[model samples]
Target: MIVATVQGNEKGGKHITVKDGVKIFGKEQQEYINNIYDKFHINRIEIIGDFGIKKIKSKEWFCYMKHPEVDASGRTGIAFIVWDKNTEDDTIEKTIREIGFRDEDYIKFNKEYNKIKKGKSNKKKQLIFLVGLGMGLAAGLIVITLSMIKK
Candidate 1:
């Protein structure tokens, strides 16, 4: 579980640190965060606020980003606050509203997460099926051997 904040402009942001509330490792942190940003299409959208939920490195994260209000002549900068999805569900729900979310976004995120879950489930299903088949075969061989001995 982790939480953090970062500031960015058109170029990009900086290293996320404990000061922001999370201690993510080197390049891996940047990669996963970028993935989350991509999944939500953050860069393409032009608005004051937005938020989303997605998995990063097998863990779910809640990200809320917004551009601070500025005068017409001033440049707008982006700020992001992120946290582990497992904790404070009610709190995060209330917080993201300051940004925005739609039922479709939830559906999309869940669809992606379930795909990952389903992939892992397929492996388990195969293992269970193999085990069951092996047991059935073993029982059949035992029954044949016993009947032969009776003869």
Candidate 2:
């Protein structure tokens, strides 16, 4: 029997390229990474959900990280954080400590989260959606009217 690969694990062969190492792409975030890889020759990419970041490690090159968002409450909040790791920089654990992802620590995730939900953001989107929907409905009605007239 064949075994199913587990996600986010080394044994899991779920990746775009897996020749020497690994590369995973999500959304339009690949270009920036490609440039870095071409220059640095990155080795692996691992997503630390607990830390809310994609950690890219390279033995020959510099390591870099990209965080999607910090989980603040019942849902995942939005705060795109990018860390350009350097030898002189503090350790990842220490850098994470500067962040407030955990409840016990500073968890500065809330600051960006609060800034996000200022207005009724979905209102404009919903209005545009409804307008498109109404236009579609009117088009259908006109088509039906024309068919009836033709008959």
In model 2, the Cα lDDT at residue 45 comes to 46
- Over 21-85, each residue of candidate 2 has an lDDT whose tens digit, in order, gives 12335642355335544543343444344323233343222222232232333233222233333
What TM-score would every model get versus the actual structure?
A: 0.38, 0.25
* Predictions in order: lDDT: 0.50, 0.36
Q: Local error of candidate 1 at 131, Å?
A: 0.5
Q: Which ranges in model 1 have alpha carbons more than 4 Å from their true place?
A: 2-7, 10-12, 16-107
Clashes of each: 0, 2
Error of 1 at 112 (Å): 1.3
| Candidate 2 residue-wise lDDT at 97 | 38
Worst 10 residues of 2 by lDDT: 1-10
